[model samples]
Target: MTRPQLTYRSWATALAALVTAAATALIGPAAPAQAAAVTFTNPLAEQRADPHVYRHTDGYYYLTATVPEYDRIVLRRATTLQGLATATERVIWRRHGSGEMGAHIWAPEIHFIDGRWYVYFAAGRTEDIWAIRPYVLESSAANPLDGPWVERGQLQPARSSFSLDATTFVHNGVRYLAWAEYAGSNSNIYLARAVNPWTYTGTPALIATPTYAWETRGYRVNEGPAVLIRNGRVFMTYSASATDASYAVGLLTAAAGSDLLNPASWSKRATPVLASDGRTGQWGPGHNSFTVAEDGSDVIVYHSRNYERYLGNGYDPLSDPNRRTRIQRVYWNADGTPNFGVPVPDGLTPVRLRSHDLPDRYLRHWEFRARLEPNVTNLADSQFRIVAGLSNASAISLESTNYPGYYLRHRNHQVWVERSDGSALFRQDATFTRRAGLADATKVSLESVNFPGQYVRHRDGLLYLEAVPDAAGRASATFALD
Candidate 1:
């Protein structure tokens, strides 16, 4: 497996200090420290949509997305999420010349189940290309990349009408299939118990209908269902409306133990959970799939147009050019619902909050216990979102990615996770001024805006706010944002 390499550089004088620290680490019971990653840009890959990034248990990330031509399925694999950008892509399957899987292929999802691989995708016939239906392709190879896929034929729900976006999940040892189908006038999300990877049993139950204003804009549609099971709940998010700027993501959730086939057991959020953020220039963000970051944090993979305007011919939105693949970290709400933050700006370089003294350690909180631990194997907890403070837009506050809605606020000179109340002290304590480090121009040092001279640093494996010291102290406070 190939992983992204991180390079570390330090001042010649600090090299001796680091060498001494390394020698001490060698003699101790602790493992060698890993270098922190300093940079990665957004729009992970370009000109791809309806992305399904699956992080296999074997330590490789498999990404499959619909090419702009809508003619075939492409697969790419990388050891790191960012590495997927340059990972070699291969077209695994293409549309048949004049048969059922003939034209307008869309939304391909690759899944490994029951020791075999299967791809669930939507396709239409050349005779009636608009009459799209869901189909499956099966591969016998242990590795999906090494596949000579066999056609498992079309998956027909009882009605045999317009159906697409078929997704499968296992709950309580029973496999279930959820997808969008024509419920008379418009498309709506439906659910049915699946007998295996490629087929469903029993009748399909309608779970979500486009009734809200957000769902009905431009067109009444509910498609592209992606399921995420966490915190004793089953969360399923689906795309809605026309495939334009009005497109958005709506959510339906049910308890983990609930009878998934019963539509009454699920509840839909009143509003769209993820939508276009005009401020960020990411329009029509939907058709999202979830994967975990290398650090074990939840990552949301989806497609969005960089520009709002559609460049396609007046008739079909699929001809639009800008629906590129993008990914960002997913945070959980204080109430346990997944929080899909607004689609971030393109070319984004995300940073993790690290301590100056403990160069190998970053801030992480578990059960509200914030501490500094070197080489945190669970890297997601160590990451914090540095956003403008609630009370003061000019000042920045650090929010824990693992524990959402909790900001690092200092009370009595001790930093801890506190509910961001937008208060004067909360803002002041949480607010930090980021400046270039004195030791390295590219490195960063964060100083407390409220405490003035006191900088966030570590001493004896614990973090503290102390008055600035000499050159070595300043060097200890510098951190590289990855």
Candidate 2:
């Protein structure tokens, strides 16, 4: 309800034009034009990881994502539902001591109960970063900006040794928590009634398991569970297989009156609900959380390894930060089930991509607060279009802007804190930097020539293209820009 206020600016002008063209297209990503997007607020950015957006009573939207470092929980609040995607963030909880939470704290969610705020997340024991489980912390303050978060302890279900990805939902007046855990033989998804919000009731129930050939990718995994109730039906969606590879998502359903504990009452859908678009080369596209669009549309936010398999095998860059986050809309199939098909075709927008009904923030950038000083021109004062080049910058140089002092900037992808003289190594806290290859200058254009049907804005910015699919590195858009 308390969404941020944003006014239209010049940066988003061209995007306003594209939306008109996008409206008249006869395709899935393309759609009939409705109303022009009026910029509101958006919070998710290039660095926020493992994002989970939650809607609360005050009408304000709250979001928390796993920082790439896996050490702290980053929280952002915005007035409008979509604004949370672009708002400034604050680190709410941090690791203390050495074991469990001291390292690898991930997937934190901020929830409001009775007047107080609480956040639930999973972290590994200090000694071993892999011995991870869910833990809760509470805040007494009205806003999460500043709070004394008291540790509420862990919610480990009985019998199951390994577990994580916990979330709570209130259905028909009863509140229950659902999560994914492995019980020795198989890594599957499960559900349980929360005695309260932080603990489970009785025994846990199995909602889904990895029985299919496709569900098992990196490891026998079925995790990241989010429960949804629509038109009197109970549904649970869980991420499947390894944290890497073509990460997939699956769904399970239970009738209104059926016992949630009865696996018989719940039936797993035969096919995967979400997966990677091989053509886009963005693999392992699972681990998702749902949020409502400004106009009540469903938005799916998940992370993916932008480039090919870069990590998990010693010194691979893929494991470090290349595993960026991405998002797309989820539509309903004729049967009424949420149809989260594969992602958009990399560069070009999805054929029928539902604009989050967000303000004009999409297809635009306006964060540049520093005034552009008029530079000495090489071409006698000609005005140039500030276009997105081989990466993600919205830069304007007088053609002479190519030089160090008159450099182009993509704020999101800019490597913060680089060496003063533009060396490879620099401090970590720096805010902006000149994009790579800006000096080398590769042509930035529509990627239609590279992949045909799909068109990409090969802008000049920090897009860590993939190496696995071999050709995936060229002419595509990834979350590094998201």
Candidate 3:
């Protein structure tokens, strides 16, 4: 089904209903839903926007963002996602005092290319703050956080106009650059072939124009283009509308081998793929980047304002200081399009449990029935918040994402989704303890709390509580979290 478009006029009324839905919709079942004790929570850093995070091959997660001050560029490195909250930051570069790049620094992205590190950022001059342009910085130091940065000059497009949020990626052996540009009275996304580290080889192609109602909500915009290439497709996501509660994300897709330079080769989705969810306290979420987690799962890093209203008295929504840097898992649909489930709420983290025997299928309930189906697509439905159960803190309850109040429960040796009744039988029946998998140490087996020795197993394409009597039973009982 197509998602509904968000409009600025209905912000107040929509937010009210969203808050109610969030209060009851737990991302997972009630209990120890947190995957680990040391895991991180959302709103990763306050007053940080246009966030870019990358997991470096050197074994560290490096992050850079536009500071609230907008006067200098800063960098942070952490060994883990949660550790970034307290990781020390260093001022890498400062805005020029009185000329080009003198003020309004915004949307800085760090990339490691050709054995050296570079930072692509947007800035405006002190005299003309709206004449924003893209610039590049080079760091010869092996560690981007270790030394001095050299100015590599501005990245001028074929046409000298207002441009920002420039990102570069290589596809099919060619390098390409994408950014947002001022087109007529609105902003639209444009693409160019990169000649080298700093300039476009030819004229920038007008790739996407904001024509839909969602893209033209408060303002006609299609900025902050972020690219993800997967499943034989090149998916580019851009932020639309105004940077307020009305702000959202729109998607453009093209075949992996298509001519990216041709504007007609790409197609835009009719609706905003990601937008503000008042229930989750994430408003105007956009300007996103992609990364990989420690377990090699796809992760999305973006900035969002927690509150809906504009704090500034002026008409400029860009002055809003509530945009906080955040991160979450990115899932894919069966048709290969990305399914970014709602930006998870602030507290406990969510996880996906994949069957050990059927590696392609993650455990998901269909109409309160548990079964092993291949290529399970919808992320929200497949994800079960695993929290410590009510009966025992160590035991966990599996909550369904689509059916918020329902949990995975076993009855008469069969596993199924049932509503939580807050009873002894319900608590005992819903809770499960993680045990070592019979097949290997890397996988795990879930044992029912009430049914002692019996483990939750997948047999003959169905789930049931049973004893592992043979190799097939052991394999069927094991699972992995991705």
TM-scores, one per candidate? 0.71, 0.63, 0.83
* Tens-digit lDDT track of model 1 for 1-482: 12321122124224434433432332222222222332234577667899998887778889998887889998989898877776778989999899688998999998888877889899999898987888999998877888999988788543378888988888888888888998777899998888777778888889889889999877899999999999999999999998888889999999998888888988999898888877567889999899887656788899998877542457456777558888887756546788775776664334465665555676666556567776564545566666665555655667765455677777777667777785687878887776666456556666789888877665555556777578767865676554
Which of candidates 1 and 2 reaches a greater TM-score?
Answer: 1
How far out, in Å, is residue 204 in model 3?
0.5
Q: Compared with the true structure, what per-residue lDDT tens digits does model 2 show for residues 156-202?
A: 44323666777877777777777766677677777778776677877
Ranking of candidates on lDDT, top first = 3, 1, 2
Which predicted model would earn the best TM-score? 3
> What lDDT does model 2 reach?
0.53
Runs of candidate 3 exceeding 4 Å displacement: 1-40, 157-159, 278-281, 307-317, 401-406, 411-425, 458-474
- TM-score, candidate 2, is 0.63
> After superposition, which runs of candidate 1 have C-alpha atoms over 4 Å from their true positions?
1-40, 156-159, 310-315, 349-482
Clash count per candidate: 3, 48, 8
C-alpha local distance difference test of each model: 0.75, 0.53, 0.78
